[model samples]
Target: MSKPRVIYWFRTDLRLHDSPALKVALDLEPECLYPIWTWDPHYVYNARVGPNRWQYLLDCQNDLSSSISKLNPRSKLFLMREGPTTLLPKLFNSWKITHLVYEKDTDAYARQRDIEIAKLAHEAGVEVVTRVGRTLWDSDRLVEKNGGKATMTQKQTIAAGDKIGNIPRPIPAPKFLPDPGELNLDFESQKPDIDADLNAPHRSSSDKSYAKIAGPNGDFAIPTMEELGLTPATTPHRGGETIALKTLAAIIKDEKYTATFEKPNTAPTAFEPQATTLLSPHLHFGSLSCREFYWRVQDVVDNYKGKASQPPTSLTGQLLFREMYFAAHAKLGFSFEQTYGNPECKFIPWHLPSKIDPKSGLKTREYIVDSAQADEWLNRWKYGRTGFPWIDAVMRQLRQEGWIHHLARHAVACFLTRGGCYIDWERGLEVFEEWLIDHEPACNVGNWQWLSCTAFFTQFFRCYSPIAFPQKWDREGKFVRRYVPELVHYPAKYIYEPWKAPIADQKKAGCLVKGDGSEFEDGQLKLYPKPMFDFNERKDLCMKGMKKAYSVGLRGNDPKVIDGSWSALFSDGDHPLGRVEQKTRVDVDEKVGRDRKRRGQGTLDNVITKKE
Candidate 1:
């Protein structure tokens, strides 16, 4: 008799350690254990993604496959056609799959997809098992009074009796994986086009050169974007498990830059300093786990005892993980449209660049205006061509390197969503999704909405002063010069505001100068355009609009509504029943330990976890 076969579906939760879903799948003790990943077109080629992120994902998948293969020698990753609902059912039915293992997804789209898949699996008589690997607390377990959704802010008010405190600690991975011989079932499915589909230009043409630049310290082969049916990106992003871990380790070991983490951005001299990890791409590709990452940092802290002045604490850990959660939910289909005053703004007025050839008078729709202008701005922002230095530099880093500081995300988003208010936040959010390797729908949407003052209770709109921002954040304009080469020749003072310099100064600075000693080059400032909207004017407009909206409101204890709620009745609210607290509890939870570890180290890694 053949041994039963169970399949593990790899999504964002990639690492093997403390992977609840993977552990549960192994517990089934099936004849064959199959691990698979899909290059779904809806996610791969969507406007919300780009080249840098694609490269990073490729690296992550490679690492994950290598890890699984080592543990289960017969376990091979099945790369198949797009659309899990369509392909997954076919594969399972064909192979007589008995059990399906996967991590629960919180994103709206994933949740819907999972429901459909679950229904399909039930009809086919296959048991589907889902584990809570993505979040610290399982969605089913974390609730408020009357079985409602548990909000982060509400958890704070409940003290020891709050929702998370009462939930059972999730089980960790077993000491050893089940043997491949135990599940001796044999099945085959058409492999995904690993080479042709993901054939993006690697750093080198030769496989050897590609491997050298790949920097992965594992046995797996990285797939190209084309192999994954993804479009070849104009630029590449760094990816893989080794790079992510190394980057985290480096941030932890650094000793000289300790002051950056000590204080918040309250004093002018103590402006917020950013420490970053380029783990988003790996996280997206299932090369890393949030729990594993938390534990890894804990290990680093334990190794570097008392080397730094400040110790890590719950406050720092909360600030760090909050953003991670924020990114995940926002990126997964919360849609950039909801982050503005007018949800209809998603379909509002916006320009699409002309693709028509001036010489031939040939009109082209390839560059037709899109309903989502917010997404368009995101494209520009990702490429670092938005003309906003602070925003562009950070965005450029994400595009070119697949990494940037966390606070930088807020700074840049503020520049786009509120700085001008002339553009849409959706555009910015989409760009973030496309370029950022760590793209989480929740965090992306939350950050954008948070900066734009679009969602939750706080309608507070903060428009950044572009002119002053350059001086404050990038005082020397080094970051701007590195990414925006057009301003390379301009003095540090004029680098950010090339349009403000005198004509002679502009000429000397190699900038285009206009007549009458003004710096308007070629109809308008070429290198640097004038401020999109008068900073003061936009500030006044946002302030008045916010004041009117929040005049009479109840401050709901929901992290989503960080600024509280308005009195106006949207009675059928998304979270109508409020937060719920679960009664049963686990003696030990990894999340609590993970949160505690941040305080013990106080390293550069801790800086990122601390609040402003």
Candidate 2:
């Protein structure tokens, strides 16, 4: 028999280091090997990727191509344009491909896409090989070990992981590569219907990414931001295997930090050199392997004499969190993204909820703008005009840069969902998907649920004080100053609550905290919006709503929730409980007295008593 003719498909894994899938492809010792990346239209048009992620992807592809060229001058990642489902079979037959090898992608859409491609490969009589390398253990296997249930918590993830064998060590990249066969793609291209484009909002110019079967230049070149008709990316985070390996080397060198690293203790305000290893984006693009990160950190803990942090909060614990989300998400396919039809997710009637896809019964990119107030608040939150400086600052940082600290994520997510705005977590999840350079579907969706108290976490009463939480990490408001520069000159006393500053003090700061968040300016003050709503009132309202929902105890998949009858069980204003009215200070005092009688302690309403 002739030697194997292989096509090494590059998808999630974009790096040369510690790639088990790449190692297996190399071990085949093929006579000819083609390292290729199909520029799938699904991502280009269907996914809600923004300019920052697109730029990062291009950077990774270019870097990987250059690295491959260095190993073997004749071999590099051959780029192709068109849907992978259509492109792969044609290439298989045309190039006389025998084996098609790639890393396993357990993402819901990816699994479906892979199944379609595998069936096509079988029809063409080409052997398709895949390996699980995205997560430490296969997400599917983890789910199976957990009795076919979602790993909802860190403890559950650890329990399920124990059944799976110890994670395999990293595989070294090949020193050399076999040259690719004849590169001639002379076939009719099934150009994606641009009318169905989901990322049309990002495109100011016409998208030319899928203009040709082999990209615009017709040499299978990586497309640029310009080619995709995207605005210039504002993010400082760059992606490449070369950069990722060096980062891991530095982190591993700091054995003390590596051994004792705790996620909770990490300062959310810290920057310049970020608090945590900003390797999440690297991990997302598979520029670095999860197994490689896990073991190196484990080696540090094993040898260190000092007491080290353990799972659920340790540096290794973060990996387990990722795995937990992956397994949980894999367990419930598309429904994992939204509360609807997800048994694990508790049904909450949030304002500005996600629009559902009728055919597939999944959430769409669009959301139902049911409440104008919720819509305006969401718009304000996204633009860093949320009145509260800490929340505003984090949102600004996220918008300007593609990354933010994890706790900062919690603050914004909590503020958006259960704590402040009473908006849907899915809204925030979609925004993260568009902006975060390191956004992983499972982690993003799972985290949103956790923060919203919709699933994983049941602490509806626990809310991050946008003011107090940031103050804990940054008492002087240095982080707020950096991102929300307008509030820079405001005193630390009033930085978190600039609207509360005396009018005379606001003048000294060269700004007045005014406006209703919907408008930009007031007179000559360059007015920042007033607090969107009474934070305490909103918090109290949400707490009451959450408790009521918990009492009902209906899951998203419940017949009542799916049939819309769930709405009848609760009221819709600010809280499921009726609203309180106090026309005067006397009335307020009386209400406070009645409140003391009703409960032992007053709600968060007393935290900041006055309205903005």
Candidate 3:
């Protein structure tokens, strides 16, 4: 029998290290192995990606390609500039491929795409092999272990993990890769339509990445940011397996830090050196294996003589949280990303709701501007002109660096959703999707839900105080000064609330706290916007809205929610009623409270305690 001619598909697992799928393909002892990556247009045109993420992806691809060349000079990651749906079959036929292999991705889109590809491969008489390496355990297995339900809590994830057996140790990288067969790509490329590209706003020049199937040089080179028409990336963070492994080595060298690390204790305001391990982007890009990182940290904890911090806060606990979100997304599929059809997500009659597709019953990736004020607030929030210094600083950091401290993310997310503006969480989610280098769909969506008190967390009453929250970490407002340079000279007392400074103090500071942060002159003193709204009043309003939403207790899958009749359930126009009309309201509130208590819902005290 002819030795299996394999095509090793590189998707989430960009690195050669600890890749289970790669190991399986090597185990087959293939005569010819073709490592390939199809540049899917779904991500290029449909996904909300910015230049920073594009740069990061290219870095990973280039590094992987170079690494592959080191193992086998005749083979590298073949860059097929077309959708996999159209490209793979042609390659299979031309190369006479006998086997297909890849790391399993449980992401909604990946799952659907993989199913179609598997069917096509079957038709072409190509066997498909896959293994889970992205997360600690297979997310689908986690859901299965959790009684076929989404792992909503850390406790549930832990329980599911326990039943799923210990997470397997990472496999070793292959020392020798098989040489690929003849390279033949004479087929025509089917380029996607760019007329309504979702990322058009991000591109400064015309996209030429798709001009040729084999790239500019016909050597299957990695596409550059210039080729994609993306503006220059502002982020300093770079991606590659080399950088990832090096960073991990440095982190592990500090055994004490690695062993006793706690997420809650990390200082969000510390910028020169971020508090937590900045390995998230690496994990997202699959430059670093989640299992590799987990085992390294776990070994440290196991060997530590001192008492180590434990889960829901510890380094290991953070990984569990990641697994939990993955399991949730795996169980819910596409519904996990949005509120409209997600049974797990709570429905809030927030301003600027998503525009749902009647045919698909899903969000159209567009939102209705229900309130002009809210729309302006969202735009200001996105551009780092929110008037709240802490919020503005965080937003600016996220925009420029494509990363922010976790607590900083919480503060800004809270201010945008339930805690302040009461705008839709989906709007804020889109911004994060566009900017964050470490933006994992499962984690981002899950974190946004938790912050907005929509799902995962139900502590709507416990909101992060934009002013007080940052003050706890940086009393001197040094972080603010670094990101929001206009407030650099302001006193620590008024830094978080710049508008509260006395006129003389503002003048002495040389930055006027006036206007709406839209004007600036090169020779003039800086001008910062005033606070957008009274924080205390907004807080109260948000609290009332959340409480009303909870009392109504309509989930995303509710008939009323699906049919757009949920608005009639609320007393105020677009606002949830603080008081309902009948005794039914009292019963609903009582039942909801009981359910919350039963679920062991956390309170503001729990968050404060965790921080302390």
The numbered model that scores best in lDDT is 3
Tens digits of lDDT, candidate 2, 396-491: 899889899999999999999999988889889988988899989999999999999999999988899988899999899999999888777899
Report the number of the highest-TM-score candidate.
3
TM-score of each: 0.67, 0.92, 0.93
Positional deviation of residue 74's Cα in model 2 after best superposition, in angstroms: 0.4
User: Considering only N, C-alpha and C atoms within 3 Å, which residue pairs clash in candidate 3?
Assistant: none
Q: How accurate is candidate 2 locally (lDDT)?
A: 0.84
Candidate 2 C-alpha error for residue 80, in Å = 1.2
Cα lDDT of all candidates, in order? 0.50, 0.84, 0.87
TM-score of 1: 0.67
Runs in model 1 lying further than 4 Å from the true structure: 1-3, 45-47, 145-162, 166-223, 228-237, 252-274, 298-387, 422-424, 456-463, 513-526, 549-612
User: Which tens-of-lDDT digit does each residue in 77-153 have in candidate 1?
Assistant: 55544457666777676667888889988776677678898999998898899987776555344433314432333
Cα misplacement distance, residue 113 of candidate 3 (Å): 0.6
Estimate the lDDT of model 3. 0.87
Off by over 4 Å in 3: 573-612
Distance from true location, Cα of 568 in model 1, Å: 16
What tens digits encode model 3's per-residue C-alpha lDDT throughout 190-267? 887765677777788998867888899998888888888999999999999999999999999899999899888899
